[model samples]
Target: MSKTEAAARLAVRKTYKLYIGGAFPRSESGRSYPVTSSKGEFLANASKASRKDARDAVSAARKAFGGWSGATAYNRGQILYRIAEMLEGRRAQFVAELAEAGTKKAGDVVDAAIDRLVWYAGWSDKITSVAGAANPVAGPYFNISSPEPTGVVAVIAPDEPLLGLVSVIAPVIVTGNTCVVVASERAPLPSITLAEVLATSDLPGGVVNVLTGSVKEIAPWLAAHMDVNAVDLTGVADEDLAITCEQAAAENLKRVLRPAAADWYADPGLKRMTAFLETKTVWHPTGV
Candidate 1:
């Protein structure tokens, strides 16, 4: 075969799809936008999620919350570790995406993201111990407090793209909270590819639904969504936009992780996990 024939045979384009309910589907709106590399090279067309798409994602997340939250901590830990393992296997793909998105150290970023997942996987069972406590009261009553998942969460993926995306997502699901994430507007290819990773992993359907589009257009719907339990605005770099979303979240009393500057490569600690948790205290009569 001639070189031209071989090159034509090898050309296979990838169609980026929206991930919802463990299925990859074209956007309900049937809209897509061009994705370009940092040097302005055309990569692919990413699904442009709409308001209805956001609603669908929320519905999927809410539907999955019960089973995910009910699963044993050990089971959740195992699943998270599995995701880390899968990511390890896809290191080359993620590195390529990160490099295309203009990251300087793509390989190091991918390594950090995998380590971040493993770190959070280890914390799956430990968070309860660290965040829960047995309290002493004046009366002869036993009081104990524990943390629980906050149901469906909406996440705005950070602009740092690959590593930032992983940093925000791992902590939420590790504790059994399902999420609908809006990928970085400019660099969404990696996030959708990560969705492909999640779909193949041990994670159940709707545990993590990802949307690719303009955050300005999609974020308000998620923030104000009545069914959504919380909103993580880690990706909203604009203070005004973040404030607007926060106000909308107030309508439903949603747990809001306000926008702030973050170093994605730094140790995230327990803050992200704790943000979407609800503390419940129980008291019982002793010696009735």
Candidate 2:
């Protein structure tokens, strides 16, 4: 082919769709919105997820919860590490997307996100030992307390996009909880690509469902969903919005992690992992 022929060939653009139940699907509402680069250039059209899509994601998460929570911690760690490996392989793509989204230090951000995944992956098996312990009782009985996953989680991903999304998500699932994540509205492209990484990383379907579009439109339905066990409001910068979610969560006594300022680059420790964990104490008599 000549240079002119090559130049005349039309570019095939990628369609950014929502990742749900291990499959990429168009928004149920059949809506899409333009995602623009930092320079106000048209990048691509991303699925505009609606309430029905959020509900579908929740259903997917709930369905996958039992099997994921039952998987061996060691296995979970391996899967998370696999995600990091796939992400590292696609480093250039993520960097370019973040740059287009106006993320400064995009390369460092992507690196930090990868390192964070590895960090949480290493913690998968070790966390139980740290978060659980034996208790002293006044009887000849063995009493112990252990951490368990808090069922399905609904997450509002932070505006920081990639790093923050990875930060919140890695910990939640590493501990064996499944989640439906609301990708950053301002920069949904990276989240879509990350979903591709998740789908190919040996992670089970429905373990994570990524929703892209307006948070205001989709978050309330998640907050009020009876089947949702927990809600992370880390991405809600609006105080009133956070309060509304908290109030709605109260209806079912859903575990709510209220909005708070976080430095995505700083040490996250075990809080994010622990936030969605529930303690179950069991007692057994020693003597027969």
For this target, which candidate reaches the highest lDDT against the unseen true structure? 2
What's the lDDT for all of these models? 0.92, 0.94
Which tens-of-lDDT digit does each residue in 1-288 have in candidate 1? 676554445668889999999998889999999999999999999999989899999999999999999999999999989988999999998988899999899999999999998999999899999999999989989999999999999999888777889899999999999999999999999988999889888899999999999999999889999999999998998888898999999998999997468888788878999999999999998994
The TM-score between candidate 2 and the true structure equals 0.97
**Candidate 2, 144-250: lDDT as tens digits:** 99999999999999988799999999989999999999999988999999999999999999999999999988888899999999999999888888888989999
In model 2, what are the clashing residue pairs, if there are any?
A: none
Off by over 4 Å in 2: 1-9
Q: How displaced is residue 45 in candidate 1, in Å?
A: 0.7
Off by over 4 Å in 1: 1-8
